[model samples]
Target chain A: MQTVKMVITGPFSSGKTEFIRTVSEIDVVATERKISSEVEKIKESTTVAMDFGRITVDDDLVLFLFGTPGQKRFDFMWEILSEGMLGFIVMVDSTRPETFREARTILETFKAYAPTPYIVAANKQDSPDAWEVEDVKHALRLDPEVKIMPCVARNKESVKTVLLELLYGILAEMEKN
Target chain B: MALKGNLRDFTITQLLNLVNLARKTGSLIIEGPTDVAQVTFRDGKLAFARLGQTDSSLATILHLNQKITAGQYRVIKERAGKMTDKELGLLLINAGYLSQEDILGSVQQYFIAIIRQLYTWVDGFFRFQPDLMPPEDKITVRLDLENLIIEGSRQMKEQEQLQEEIPSLDMALKFSERPGTNLRNVSLSVEEWRVVSYINPKNTIRQIAKANKMNDLAIRRVVFSLLQAGLVQLARPEGMPVAPVTSSSSSRPGAAPLPVTNKEEQKSLVNRLISRIRSL
Candidate 1:
């Protein structure tokens, strides 16, 4: 086992958990959800610690995806997660595109540790009210210089493209080093 | 959960209190789940406000919603998209007029930061510059009970406020408006700039909010102000990021970071911010 680590992160309800579930060959272990008096529905219980899952790409390529806690408080764990990690998978909700700024906060915090390669999955572009790609890019102010791949996370084709892009991003980072 | 404003997250009510308690002139940066805003102050009044990285079209929508002022719109337009929405939101709060509901709704592009308790920030975020003299031309504001509370509670958990917006009649006049400045002359509170410097083609405002430990609305305002100031430009210069999803910023080629002289410079930056805001 080469033991390459990958992290899946995004805003709450952005299908971060679902994305990992779809890709990982093993069952994902998540935190248990308990109901509170105020909010009746089962809100996705926050992953206070981490969400663990695994996938084997080939003979020796075992990819370990550790999903992180979405609430800002859990950010302290990122330093530990990114330590010796290969890269990350950044997910997004295009319909709620502006949420991307929160992702910037984490990246900025980790700037000193090391610049990791990551792929962006603009999840839910297939939604009816999704903001146009142009609008999303302009509003989010993504760097034009970087390669941004558009993908509908639920669709296998789109998901595959994102994986490819993420892999390329990792490769590009490796080449730069 | 707390979110980052600049680089720190404030509680939902703390932001509401910041809006109610802010007295100094200049931009109050408000960071929310999605967008950012810059609220300008003049003579300790809410003068103007505008979104960060916004153009005339989107700005008009914000203005129509009573989110910013005409003067602030002009100032922000002048700066272009350099300021991020977070910075702008913080500036607006300092100048007053922006309510937690309105700002949270806009920045997150969804309703977040629900104001529960209404007490003002008995302790507002303030860092004054003793080295730089306060401008003589402006009318001296008489510090009132609210100011006292803010000053008294500067380091406390969250300032107390009765309502999310201007809770009292006096606040309306107190936070009515002030001077203004573009990114160059007026700058972020050191805390405010910390987050603005992070936005790139890779991250979404929501993701940033989730990752931050401070208040999201507060961060949005700082980003908005930076966008207004032209200090922190966005990667998507024209429209929002066109990418379907935003990734982590691919460590772009290095750009020289801003240099800070000393604590005095920081204070001076805050004071200059106050002065220019009063001018507008």
Candidate 2:
């Protein structure tokens, strides 16, 4: 049996777990704990360790999805989760502009760890006040070639689109090699 | 739907860039914690702006600019209360009290000032009402926003860099042990001196900023300069409670560090993944 790994990461509450759950065939194994930080009152609980999900493309090819915790304290897990990954997705809350800076930092850090294929998923696009994908791209200071896809993690179609975009990016990199 | 969001998530600079790039025509209403601002644009060009409930009338602007005397300003306020800005401006121009250029220039300056003030507002709610125009009676100008956008973008970049350098305003600052040069010999700006005077291990950068009447950006800039000069370093505020460490476990801990796949194997795997995703 062959398994390919893909990691999902972003700032706090950027929908990394939801994105995984929306597509994962099995019940995602999430290590969630009550949030203790006063600043993160937006959510009741946050992923403490990581989220594990899997998709069986076929009998022989299974895909693994890992989501890293978002808090700065859990930054050590980023490198560990990123290891041996085929590609990664940097999710950003489209309605929250303040997280854009952190999103950029996470992207840079992941890129530095491994020059792997990745795409930014601007999640929460369903919100009325959500920033446009182009605006999110500009705010993130992303290069022209870096794809930023609009996503709503709860919506399976949107999640699929984001995952497909990242897969295409990986395929392109593979073709180049 | 109206375009609306908090300033925390989308800055005034980014909003302006969007307006300019999209050539949007509307009124951007920003509600700050204490005040409200309305900026009008036509074809993406700045036309007018008003802050709070203050008088942004042509006569008031002229008076504030010293184009009119105090007595004239008082009389105009008393008698021209019913006149619209356009009517007042035309009346002034006809009476030779002010030239068209003077009125337009003053209005432009006032509008720009309002926009500049908006930049300092980090926490606010802004909503763009598309196709909204300023009052018909109000005088408007067609000032290009390109320069303002450029200036704002530059300031935003500087502020971001400063914030990155000084991640937390709650963090205190302490003078470096080895300055390599005497602090007394070093030339410092008035703002820098003020910040330095408040530099104590007990006083967080936020406290220093509050004492000096400096905003987050100002304090960060000052502290960042001090840090770059080796004059001060960030330290935990005295007696502040430390956060408890939370350990995280990574999945597949004992897995290989790097993907162990030949080009052919990777290609086949990617193709299979792509086919599966596309079908989904």
Candidate 3:
């Protein structure tokens, strides 16, 4: 089967790993490390390396998903991971209004490195304080052509919708190219 | 005689508590695998901290925390050439980016953060130099070492438990055939949910850790807690080969047969790691 690399990336706690975990047919491989800093107050560990997962779609094609570490210190991992990627997904945590800038930074970094078709998944939309899709779009300063899908990453259906949206985007980009 | 020893012979936690309780004034210098750190104590309180090259600069921390933008960081870096870390912090305050209190708070946090990382090291050498004061020019942030000892020890215990429970990185995780006996009250965290979702019979703890962008210790802790909750169990014994799931040209090569857990093997690993650190 032909294999395509797809990257899922975002800032801290944006649900990139969770999204991949939700969709991956195979078990996801991750390199999580204990966070010694104040970030540990929020979460026990952070991704220092990359997250890997795979899905076999039909007999003809396979999708390999790689999730980048959220911190800048691991930006080198992004460079290594984005190589030969078909497309990518950028997730934004809607509830973390302050993190929009970081998410934008991640999106820009991915675009610069991959230059492939991509869509933004505004995750954690189920949270009470989660920004509206429109608000997230505004916060991220996304272009009109860019698709922003609000998703609850923990939900299988929601994660599937996000993946399908990216797949369609990839297909469209491939056709254009 | 000055107190000095390898960490294998003396626990850092005990040393910290001993100094704190004694109300000693000294600098505890710890040399780890790659870098060295000095923790200055004044009458039992952690007066200040200094670390070797591996420690991230204040600007880097600020940038990472998103307190400063990339442009601002570059400008700060260019402008603060030759300035000490303390001076750079003061500059941040003078530039209206951070207040004095904020800078002080960050200093304390930054020191504690490095100390937290140091606490994780199983091998290192330590020396307590008596009657040495912290640098007068540096920003001094005092901490109650006893409080730090309590917190650090708790975290260390958790880490120990994780390592003890999941000794081998390659152990596979499988969900229990019987659902955890107590169901209704047990709520899972987002991380737990992610771990649970990826619990295929074939994936080892190491692979799961990699896919989740987590270290073995973190993954092991999750798996250990799940086991305690009766949510998951080990699928295979240590050193057993799970069927290789990789195709031809796969990035993952088979795990090399690990050396038996003997003193010689450990000595070899330590020597290899030290050389690796030196090369870096």
Candidate 4:
């Protein structure tokens, strides 16, 4: 069976682990530690190292999802997880517009390592205060060709839709090559 | 020359303790990635603190603490938006919503909260200028820097320990479907039971923290202890599929997977989302 490794990355509390847990067939294994500082206002615990999960895409192919810690202090793990990955999903918390800058930086960092396809998942779409997908796209300065999708990472179907999109992007890229 | 450097080298607590020991009077300004805050000290005690626009206002703090109703908060905020710090305090008192003591107490609480937050900043530049005057008529809440530092540091250390056990607040928790027998013999704290009442695999630790008005570390510590006692287990929400339901042994279903990059469909989704924002 062929294995495809994909990454789910974003800023703090951007729902990377939730997205992976939603779509993964197996339980997600995550290394989380309590954050003491002001970030405790956002969430108590944060992913310290990485979150891992896997899914079977038919008998011959399987998909593995690796979620990188949101904080920049953990950026060193980004390269480690991104290696040999087919593509990735950049999650963003729509309610926290301030995190958009970090989301862009993550996207750029991964793209620098490999020119792989990616989808910007605007999470927290259910929140009334969340930004519109168009506005998020504009704020992130995403090129027209880059796909931006709104998702509630907590929802299994929504997470599946995002993964499918990233998979499609990868397939199309593979066709080009 | 003013004392200035990255906070990483000299923590806010260390700086405050130094100033307090020397009995220096001045303003200590911290510039962080998201906000800038200035704390004035008179004779080595905290006189006043002014934070950048990103920090929560007194009204927000009051609202979060449930000291003021949402409606009352809105009115106060609308009326006090243009008022100075001193004027706002007066307005709150004159409106009969808060007594003089309440105002003072809230101010102190707000001050402590801001300092605690500043202690968490790993990357920031700090500057100290001696002999700066307090803002005009601003409420001056003098606090012993040594005591404040000790308390803040203690809380930070406690939070770090709790974080070691509790990973992320995004984790959904539920009473263990097969709880261990130890739960029957173990006594739970009032706070633990309160947290247990909220666990249903539907509420994340973050949501539970918000519901209880506790900070992240406080909630996680409670949850961590519960997990250790085998009373609760982390689980995904119900209806979330753990894996692909259908799979074949030898077929490459991904080769013909449903397409997600149809430009026309994406454009429409964006249009719908934009309309939702406009309606708001």
Candidate 5:
């Protein structure tokens, strides 16, 4: 089977684990109760640091999906974790608009280290008051060619739609080569 | 066999069973890793998922393939139990244990867990959509009333005469229109199309590669082409297949109003960064 590596990089509790759970073809084996209470007082548990899964787009190919730590302190670790990585799904929360810069920094870092393609999933599109898709793009200053999809990370439909977009982005990148 | 209420009160496996039986649509929101994940379902079939804010510069995820110890995983859960997903992702990323790519990968997997559990929870007791918002972190999803009493009695008699109708893989595949695609004329390399054909909407790439001797990388390239062309898709795994007859839910009085908790948490860490920015 041909495999491509993709990573799920986002803030803590931004549905990294859940995203992995829903898109992977097989059942994901998660470490139950993987968290610290003291941390809980500061944050949420459920999927503390990271999660893993894979997607089969067809009979011959599979994407090795990776999720990273949700905390900023873990940023230094990404260089090591992202070696030979194909692309990334930058999970964003439209509910909170202040995080635009943080997302940009990570993308800039990627550009500096590796010229990889990426797609943005403006999650929580289900929320009644989510920022407009255009507003998000304007805020993030993303490229028009980049596929930034509207989605509710909780819904498989929305998730699938975005996956197709990112996969396309990956293919587009490969085509450029 | 029936499925019941939302998964806030049930385990992962339990939730998936409910999804399969109801053939419901919408998304299940799981508050894991400090973020709210929405996994969409149609006719109780798995659809798609995403994480983080598409608009933000701070938005990132884990590599998804890195395996963690139950203990370290516990620390994340405990920390995220209190903090918001954004807070947690930033915390870990800054802490230097995970990368943005890695987090994205994990976010995808966590979503799969919610989808899988929907199958396990479908035992005729409760009925609920994982996508709907619950009144509390752990609220009971009241089942449909009329069917609960009626179906309970009917099950005893029906079991004697009924043989469980199992759906074939092809039938389940029908849930996705396959985009009614024709792969011809596309600029596919022999290696790329070989990989693309393997990335069926229904199976995982790992599963496909296991069946064939192809390297996962080649297949991934093709899958990307199909995805770009809108011919195939990737979704969380729905539970085991069942017959055409969907399940029922119990009737509960109108749901109580959910408590107001600030969905967004304080960006203290980032706040510090922001403050530093302003000072600069």
Candidate 6:
């Protein structure tokens, strides 16, 4: 069977795992551990290693979703997971402005890794305090051409929309070549 | 719901930029380590600010600016106790004690000073209360935030550069092994010398910063200069978490790079993925 890979990355607790789990047809394989740092106060556990999920598009095509570990120390795994991926998504917790810088860093790192199409998923858009997608784009200093889509990661429809937008970006890149 | 977050994540500059760009009218209440500040904005312009429990009364401000004498200040404080700042200002203007320009200028200066003090506060919790206006009893002024935003942006850029150079405070520092460029030969500032004395393989930069009573920006600046001078080098502190590893190359070891796909193959794959997602 032919398979394609897409990596999901962002800062700590930016909903990488949830994004993958929502759309993955198979049960996600997550290596989550109880967070021991001060971050534990925010969430009980975090992805320590990586989260794996899969989608069988059809009998002839399949897609693999890889979620990178978000903490700074786990940064080494980003390059490993990003290798040979067709595209990627940089997720941001829309309610948290502090994680914006880290999100930008991750975006830049991934861009440097490969000349691939990508999109920024502004997760947690359902939160009342969540920043607008335009504000997030401005804060991240993203180009106007780069799509920053509002996303509620837990919603299957929203996750599907983000994935479809990314596929369109890839298709455009292919047509350009 | 009110907009709120830690200052460490969204900075004052970013907050100001958002307010300016969005033309927001609100009160941004910031709770610093030891004090709380409330700065009100009108259509993105700075309208008023109060820091902690400081005296921000109109009479006090006028007196501080020498627009009113000490005797007048005391008399106003004792007799105009129940009168609002607007009422008191009108009375003063009618009695020829001060002009409108005098009162507004002094208040604006005071508010700007409070905002300048807030620029130094890197760690705090801030919330923006939408359409929260200053008390009617207090005086307010509309001062353009463009200049303040520009200055704050400059400061933020400098701080960001320093952080980029020294990404982590958990890492320790050691004297460089170069035969030349010793500390004795270099002329170091008092602050630099203070930081230099604390450099060691076991003492993390955070410890050094705490010992010297320096904040994150201050400590990063000192360490960045030392690194530039080749006087110190970063080292992982004993038993500390591993520092981030940055890869200069496209792919890291142990991860086999994917073979490049041709345009036709990529297009077909994307078309198939799109079709699947659209169907979902």
Chain B TM-score against the true chain B, each candidate: 0.21, 0.75, 0.60, 0.52, 0.26, 0.68
On DockQ, the stronger of 1 and 4 is: 4
Query: What's the distance in Å from true for residue A145, model 5?
Result: 3.3
Relative to the real complex, the DockQ score for model 4 comes to: 0.04
Model 2 segments more than 4 A misplaced = A175-177, B1-10, B69-79, B92-99, B153-268
lDDT of 2 by residue, A56-134 (tens): 9999999999999988788888888888888899999988877888999889888877778899999998888787787
List the lowest-lDDT window of 10 residues for candidate 4 chain A: A168-177
> In terms of docking quality, how is candidate 6 classified?
acceptable
Q: Give all candidate RMSDs, comma-separated.
A: 24.6, 5.7, 25.3, 20.1, 29.8, 6.2
Error of 1 at B234 (Å): 36
DockQ of each: 0.01, 0.39, 0.01, 0.04, 0.01, 0.43
CAPRI verdict on model 3? incorrect
Model 4 clashing-pair count: 4
lDDT of 5 by residue, A21-89 (tens): 776766764433445656434344554345667765446555667777666655655655466666678
Ranking by lDDT: 6, 2, 4, 3, 5, 1
Q: What tens digits encode model 3's per-residue C-alpha lDDT throughout A94-132?
A: 776557778887787777665677899988888766766
Which residue pairs in candidate 6 collide? A98-B9
Number of the candidate with higher DockQ, 5 or 6: 6
Q: How much is the lDDT of residue A56 in candidate 2?
A: 91
lDDT at position A22, candidate 4: 78
Model 2 TM: 0.77
Model 2 steric clash pairs: A97-B9
Q: Write the per-residue lDDT of candidate 4 for residues A1-177, one digit (tens) a residue.
A: 656678899888999999988767688998998886675348878898999988765565566789999876778778778876767899998876667777888888777766668899999999876766765676576888999998999997788678767766765665565
Tell me, by DockQ, which candidate is best.
6
